[model samples]
Target: MLHTLCNVESGRLSRVEAEEEFTVDQLAAKVGMTVRNVRAYAGRGLIPPPRLVGRTGYYGPDHVARLTLVQELLGKGYTLAAVERMMSELPDGAMALGVFQTLVNPWTPSEPEELDELQLAEAAGIPHDPAIIAKLVELGIAERMDNGHLRIPNPDLLRTGLEVIKLGVPLDAIFILLPKLFAQADAVAKTYVELFRSTVWRQFADAGLPAEGWPEIQRTLENIIPLAGQALVAAFREAMAREIEVVAYEELGLDPNTLPSTG
Candidate 1:
């Protein structure tokens, strides 16, 4: 009787239908759980019971979805107690989605400001190594202007190098790591760009957002790129630390208890 009512009335119910028309058995079956277990979960306040309308009960799809969600979390190694707390204490998915948008979305930069080559070098504090400059010039990293001034061909390389200057590593050592690091950043950037192109663009188009919103969308994504890049670097650093501190330490004949200054 309850199954037939659910089938007949499911289409009539709003997205968040009133919970006064569902029974414990009906909700349990919807989430593939038994009635007694559903009742036990309700008793423990892990799942909320349906509303009672003069002894007839109903639950919305949100209730059914929550049950399935909890089951999935448990299957993914979360304790029932943890799932219960998460259900009670956590905000809805929309909140997390909003945060992801804020974090991952690109933000616009202020209008472009022009800085000349000399200004760029001074701002970046290019070391006065005439020999290195000559090598860079030969390698096409820097170029000579017609007016006899030197110019940086790729400004990002100079900026990234300046940014890492305070890390206490020698320039030669840093050079070894720079190519691989930039390559990793480039790969991660490509992934996000592809995601925006394939997924976000389609989503925006389907939602009928204006074409003018594209810049704002790209800005938000660009803003997110640095954050995502930093996150990847942090994760890599942890993994590298584990390998260097533990795995390689024993092979180097060092005591783990008396590890060298990691600082």
Candidate 2:
């Protein structure tokens, strides 16, 4: 039988097989593990033993979750013994599963898109500059696939770069400025991430991350994702306005304070 559960991060309900049963082979297939590995995990006490009915054994959702968690931990370079200790520390069932899901599911603004060579060149307004394309790839703006196609990870950023190029900015100048912009953006991102880490995540950890509060914590993170962008834009505009005024006063000798008021 299929079951439904709340997707805490998106505030949407997702259908998961809560009570569905699986044979050892079915469980291995379901969790993308080999049967031998599944048996080893069960034998090693890394996961709970299946329920035996006569000659057959059945696995459930909790077993699937535990196996997934183990796989994720192993993928991250944790030893099997370390993974066992980590799982042993956490409370079973919903609490462990919720925490794992939260860690695995990050908030992404949008999906990446693939573009042909001609389309990428048109977007960047550099029709035949192999050097510019190389620079873009080096800067992590886009990636060149094995098939020679390009994948634009952040289309909005690419479009913004194209707009600047359309303003007659020299390619060399843009390339130099792009790295500085990225560096500054990285610093800002670190500050914002630290803010969230110190506040919300810290509180969650301090409270022992109770299962009852997982949904609320997830909702808070979801709300923060967009709100953080809005806040950054608002702050940047204000800073830019102040800096523009200062630059005009120094370079063009035009002081806004001394100008006659329009009113």
Candidate 3:
């Protein structure tokens, strides 16, 4: 799905992906939104209109990406009115915005599933505690629906969490640690973004973001997103090894340096 192209401005090679398209219903499912919500957003100019063929309409991947963004922003309390204004403010219109959005979105998780409280309780093998359900909703893991079903966003995350809970880790302890983890991750993420903005993006902006240079910008941003994740994982592994050595030395009078090492 990846293809190489030359940036017309720089005459340098870059890569882009084949954009996927979907129907309204599929688009709704992709981003965990209702069909009505998608239609409404399209009606209000929040998203671009679909291409028409015969009587059916089809939305492109950009539309799906934009909806994902809208879901995240709205979950964080951004109103539709505010979102519309912000979308309008993007440079060089929707095409640029689409590529820009993909680069900027922190993470892309899988599609969600709608499960009732009873279903979730059974899946996770836990009691149906209202307090815990409320907390989950607050954390954006799930959304309580009008029909009393819960929309589990990032179902894989929920599954992993359930596995840890089943291993006897207290949910309360996990919740207490979540904020600190998020703060550290957020700080590291901002550092990477600021690095891009100050250097690569700054030069692009200085040149006025010429349309021909978009492919290079897209290429630059797309490449960094995964590299940032890899870098974080590497750094965390190194730090954890050091921490583990210290913990073992202090608690069990074990020194890793004295043990036979494997290369």
The sequence of per-residue lDDT tens digits that candidate 1 reaches over residues 111-174 is: 2234445564566466466665565566545676667666664666665676776555566666
What tens digits encode model 3's per-residue C-alpha lDDT throughout 113-162? 89888888887788888998898888778898889899886787788888
In the order shown, what is each candidate's alpha-carbon RMSD? 22.0, 7.7, 8.0
Best by lDDT: 2
Q: Which of 1 and 3 is ahead in lDDT? A: 3
Of 1 and 2, the candidate ahead on TM-score is 2
Stretches off by above 4 angstroms in model 3 are: 1-80, 103-106, 253-263
Which regions of candidate 1 are displaced past 4 Å? 1-131, 137-143, 152-173, 206-219, 246-251, 254-263
Candidate 2's C-alpha runs over 4 A off are 1-106, 256-263
Q: Is candidate 1 or candidate 2 better by lDDT?
A: 2
lDDT (tens digit, per residue) of candidate 2 on 1-263: 00112223322223234579899999999999999999999887877677899989998887888898889789656899887766655445654466556655555556767987788777666676777778889998889887988888787787788898899998789789989998987887678767877887778667655556657766665677578789989988877777777777778877767643333
TM-score of each: 0.37, 0.66, 0.65
Please give the distance, in angstroms, between residue 203's alpha carbon in candidate 2 and its true position after superposition. 2.9
Q: What ranking of all candidate models by lDDT puts the best one first?
A: 2, 3, 1
